[model samples]
Target: MKLFLVRGTAKGTLVPRSALCEPRAPHFLHEPPARVEFLNGTGAVVPCVVHGSPPPRVTWTTRAGQPLHEVPGLRHMRPDGSLVLPPFRAEDFKEDVHSAVYRCLGTNSLGTIGSHDVRVRAGERLGTLSV
Candidate 1:
């Protein structure tokens, strides 16, 4: 596509190649694995890396399409758009919270795209030593 940089009422003629930028659909740089296994209390990090010409907004949701907001100290989303399930105490482990499927939605003016389902599983940490 041709791009013209007009100045005021003056007509633009030559445009630099570097000025050639276009809006495009969001593309995932890297997505979370199908399943993630983490030691209980250690938690996990589910990444949803994505990018587009105009940049995109990121959001996490359940399999049923419910908005998954951060649960105080339990979970949070990083500035880089990665979901962080912070480490927790063994007694605070919740089956529903520790093990579930999540979807990452990346949206921009062009459109929105969703990452594949990411299922996280938490395992009990027996003793300090891991086999």
Candidate 2:
């Protein structure tokens, strides 16, 4: 028996199947986080979703240039790329360190992409007085 193989054509050129498929770079599937305000002693979440051919690593950074992993128990990145900020105590507000901008970065073999700046603010609860 005799047989022949056929290849796909693109732009009038015969192309191999392998050449037709290429890996796509990472990209944001949804808009980045926006300005969010959380009452002191309340939790907050920032969502960041990305898409790519090989998937990507998600990282979070604070306005002070501190990495999320270094923040200890105060903040962390969820499995789904959401930044979780746990409830802040009154003392946390005193230094105004918890209130700052946050940024999300996605990285893959192709390249790296950054999300829009997200401003996170922690404010004192209503009717609460500082001693």
Candidate 3:
């Protein structure tokens, strides 16, 4: 008898792998938090947890379905199940943050899972700023 490994991707189709080749494991959501906080001057930070026979490749995207670019202000964790936002600046809030959205992506040899949409906003002040 002989054993074979099958691999798959979002595009479709599966291929066989040699015994030496590492098999792709299914990426599962382990401890992904439902909601997170966006600090007053700090950007949003969401934690992602995943486990499987093989670790998963993690990435992030905006709610609007935009890919997160590798920049100073924005950042993400690799195979680990963690995320970070370097630092938030005024320009990051200049945009329409009211409609901003955040999401977590996890992909492994087996499959992938994404977190729910995370909305970011500026904290409210009790008293109004008077001139």
In model 3, which runs have C-alpha deviations exceeding 4 angstroms? Answer: 1-30, 42-44, 74-79, 91-99, 124-131
- Candidate with top TM-score is 1
Please name the candidate that would achieve the greatest lDDT relative to the true structure: 1
> Cα-based RMSD of the predictions, in order?
6.5, 7.7, 9.9
Candidate 3 lDDT over 1-131, as tens digits, reads: 45544546575544544443566554545545655445445555556776554666677777777776655545555446566654455445433342356677777767877777765444422232111
For model 2, how does the per-residue alpha-carbon lDDT over 22-107 read when each residue is reduced to its tens digit? 56677998646578777777768878998776688888876665676735557778899988878877665533336677788888
Better candidate number, 2 or 3, judged by TM-score: 2
Which ten contiguous residues of candidate 2 have the minimum total lDDT? 1-10
Question: Across residues 48-103, which tens digit of lDDT does each residue of candidate 1 receive?
Answer: 89898789998889878888888887778897888888888778777666778888
Q: Could you tell me the TM-score of candidate 2?
A: 0.69
* Decoy 3 TM-score against native: 0.55
Off by over 4 Å in 1: 1-20, 126-131
Clashing pairs in 1: none
Candidate 1 vs 2: which has more TM-score? 1
Kindly give the number of clashing pairs for every candidate: 0, 0, 5
Worst 10-residue lDDT window, candidate 1: 122-131
